[model samples]
Target: MGVQWSDAADGPIGGDLTAVLAYATPAGGAVLTPIAPIGLRDRDAGRLTFTTSLGFGRKLDRIRSNPAIALAYHDRAHGFGASSAYVLVQGRATIVERPDREYLETVVGPAAARFLGAPRRGPFWDRWLAAYYADRVPVHVDIERVVTWPDLRCAGDPVVDGEPLPAGPPASQAPPKKGAVPRVDVAKGARRLRGMSDLLLGYPGADGRPWVVPVGLRADDPRGYELSAAPGLLHPGARRAGLVGHRYNAQLVGLAMRQHTGWLEVADDGSARYAPHTDAGFAAPANKTLLLLTNGFLARRGLKQAQRARAAEAAT
Candidate 1:
């Protein structure tokens, strides 16, 4: 059975500006990325939607191959939501690769404006952001399960609504070819992420779908940060994993985020540690104009690169 969103789940699901999206990697790990889930596309069916640029070809490709994904709504410091509940939605994604312009302008545009303000117009802006605005794809998730905690901290026992979770972690895939050694200074990376308000850890679950949960740093080890989450949330074993730490102001006008992909070790006693192999992050400008400019520039560059890559593939 699908999850039926209760009033408690509705607040954050319908009003939060951003949610942490986790999608499976071919190597059997999960990559955590933050996305703006504009709003619930269908309340009764529990259909959630978000859009990404055509420029993000690699992520789009991953979703196309493995549709199972998860979204965690763990932050409530901004936007219209008033609920304190932390919600996690696990489902299958259906990507709308070439939605018509009318749908983009009428359906997606209005919902975006509610949270991001009106889109920039004029000939110069339009020409500058053509790819960013016009070349987008929407991904809709059909909710299979919903897990909620009483508050953002996930302090109380979770109340699950919908399908039952699998009994254990999924069969492990082949280990990544490369070694999982930390690529950056573990201590430096931990210090930078420790202050963020929302920290999430994600890994592949029993159904081969990604499972995400809010976690905190239990201790700072020389190799990595020890992780603490609700009891039974962390499966016992080592696996490829991802961690994201983020914070944002009202309407997502200002933000700082850090993401890392690495190896996670969970002991039989439930202790966990994450050693980051790679780290990447950014701080979005507080000024909307500057942010839009940055987005436009990046989108244009990414689109061009994607096109070139596609052309090269065809030439072979």
Candidate 2:
């Protein structure tokens, strides 16, 4: 409840600016990438559309091979204590190349109206989007399933083709998670992952949507943990990366909050095992000391940055 916006009006979709499109790769892993939808939250219809270049992108290939995809959005403006409200949309997408004037005016027109501050006339925004839309495509994601955390009251069920989609387990339900990734609290999750020297980040690539690339995570004060991906793996408009070492590291803190039960134990032989809460002899002490040292380093770095900025201003 960081900022008060009626759930009935906005639902859990957040604003147009706050969403990530996720699709499965040929290898079965998932890549969560950001997207800006042009349409308003249509809870009843259970469908929303986004505008993207129809160029030779990895997502386009994945969609052509498999239309089943998911979009996850969380309102970062507001915070619900440790957790944030989020929505997961599982759907099929249809990409229309060289979309006609009629479809843009009728479908994506009204959605673009608010941002452009103009009516849905083809000549206006159509030409504007043309520069990017030329040979590009508009992907209309048909919502087959919609899941939200901290469910809020809405006007109607998310419907598809005149029928309401079946409800899913509440987001709070942990469910049976596979893998050795031990669940941890949202706050400590990223910090713990930052301790790892080498981790893998999955994003869309020529190989597949969830192409895995190794990365190193280091914590910095004021900025939190910073992730550096492999060379050429990071590019503009494709900043989001999924943690590969374990799914428990959690995604962006603002997206979904997780609960932790125990931590992972790494042996001298490089073998890793989940440590129960009762096991207190492992690296708990060393881990705590390391985290404190990292925090101190970050604080010093922040101070240095601030001093440099001040020095530049004085010189000017």
Q: Model 1 compared with the native: what TM-score?
A: 0.93
Encode model 1's per-residue lDDT on 26-111: one tens digit a residue.
Answer: 77888999888877558677688899998878888889999999999887766689999998888899999778789888999999
lDDT of 2 by residue, 1-316 (tens): 0112235324445353435566665534455444446444445555566766533355566677777766655433322122334455556787775688676666566555443334323664454434333333578667655544442221222222222332321111122245323333333555555443324443333323223333455432322234453233333321223452222111111222111223222233322232211111112122433433332343445445645765788999
Clashes per candidate, residues 3 or more apart or on different chains:
0, 4
Models 1 onward score TM values of: 0.93, 0.42
lDDT of each: 0.84, 0.42
- Steric clash pairs (candidate 1): none
| List of clashing residue pairs for candidate 2 | 54-136, 54-137, 183-260, 184-260
